[model samples]
Target: MEILLNLKNRICSLGIPLHAAFEDIGTDKTVELWSEIFLNCGQIMKEQRLDAGSAWKKVISENRGLLPLEQADWDSINDFGELLGKSDRLNQESVLDMARESIALLEKKAEEAMKTKGKLYRNLGALCGAAVVIVLI
Candidate 1:
């Protein structure tokens, strides 16, 4: 989410290309995969003379098994690629903003689910430990 936000801001304010924006955002150390994805997409777009959308698709396809995203996140990412570099600057920014929003919502949902499931697992572990203690006694 931070990367997406930073990319959008950079593209909108600095008018940087998608690949450049991604490269800048990829410098962050929070997630290694994001850096790899950004660098790979940049290389694909530059070397192959492909558009941002096509380059993004290629990168995603190659890294599909390694990505830890949910279905909604994947959909948002693919959708963002479809609009990227296919329209005017304003439209590109709008697409980025929309993708950021979609990812933000997905993050919220994931956080909520984590909280709920974390409690459940903690309780389950406690119960199992109690059962084991009783059996030993």
Candidate 2:
């Protein structure tokens, strides 16, 4: 469960840089930036070790610039990753458009997750954790 959450965060985290690179670095330059981003992602996974989620949050916070990633923006990121893996269109506009859509979707999701009703889910997590400990004992 935590792995999924962290992966969601990482995927959203990746879109932040990719979106910025598309806008700031321009289409012609993003290939290099994409490679660099992948490298940074691998390093994030490696360096975080046992505390990956928090460490990744910090790493992303430090590098995410002004683009705030919310809880709602997280769900579609795994789907986006799947599409990216199968996609063969490496052209500038194609990749840029995909990145743009991902950014928008993720941002929207984050906003939704912060809404009033979503607070209930926090207790559910605690319940699940307590169940696990009970099972262990």
Candidate 3:
């Protein structure tokens, strides 16, 4: 549950850099902007002791139920990363759309998580704890 909430928070915060990077692309070479985005993101991930690509893979892989806030959301993020990680030429405008789409997705998921998911997790956790106590007794 904590991990889920943290993931949601992390995703939401990640959007700030993405948005800024998208805007930066308008004034700079698309390729250079993308390199900066990946570098900045990679550095941030490093601070958390996570590799650029492995962070997403590790978090999603390690806890399935914990962060299944939305499979589509995860897929979109993964796709975005893959797109950026590639050598293919990506249009600045199209990249902006992708970043915007991802931002919106994260925001929606964050709102939904706060509204209900957190409570559900708390309740379920409590139930599990009670079950463990009862079993011991």
Candidate 4:
């Protein structure tokens, strides 16, 4: 999300090209897999002169399983890819912002679910241990 936001700011404010922005962001070490994906997409965009949408879709499809993104997150990314290079810069920035918001919402929901389910599972484990102890006694 931060990466996408940064890309949006660079593209919108700095007027850097999409591929150039990706290549620059790809240098980050903490996100090696995403960095590789960004590099591949950047190369495709530069070498093949493909649109941002096409390059992004190609790279994402090839590396879908390795992305560590949920289906909703992938859907947001796909929507962003579909919008990229197909519209004006303002529109692209708006699309990125929307994707960021949607992904944030999904993240919040997932965290809440984890908290609830984690507590339930912990309680169940404790109950099962108590049952086993009672049986032994």
Highest lDDT: give the candidate number: 4
Given candidate 1, what's the lDDT at residue 104? 80
- TM for candidate 1 is 0.81
Model 4 over residues 33-121: C-alpha lDDT tens digits? 88898888888999999988889889998999986677877876765566665677888788878878977897898899889999999
C-alpha positional error of residue 43 in candidate 4 after TM-score superposition, expressed in Å = 1.5
Candidate 1 per-residue lDDT over residues 1-137, each given as its tens digit: 77776777777777888777666666666778878888888777778888888888888878878977777678767756777767777887788788888878888988998999999999999999999999999
- Candidate 2 residue spans exceeding 4 A from truth: 1-37, 41-90, 118-137
lDDT assessment of candidate 4: 0.83
Model 3 misplaced regions, further than 4 Å: 1-37, 40-71, 82-90, 118-137
TM-score of each: 0.81, 0.28, 0.33, 0.83
The C-alpha stretches of model 1 lying farther than 4 A from their native spots are 27-31
- Per lDDT, what order, best first? 4, 1, 3, 2
Candidate number of the best TM-score: 4
For model 2, give the 10-residue run with minimal summed lDDT: 19-28
lDDT of 2 by residue, 1-137 (tens): 22223333433444433333222322233355333433454454445442333433444445544334444443333233333322332442354366566666665655776774576678788889999999999
Q: Residue 26 lDDT in model 4?
A: 84
How far in Å is the alpha carbon of 85 misplaced in model 1? Answer: 1.4
- Preferred candidate (TM-score higher): 1 or 2: 1
lDDT of 4 at 134: 100
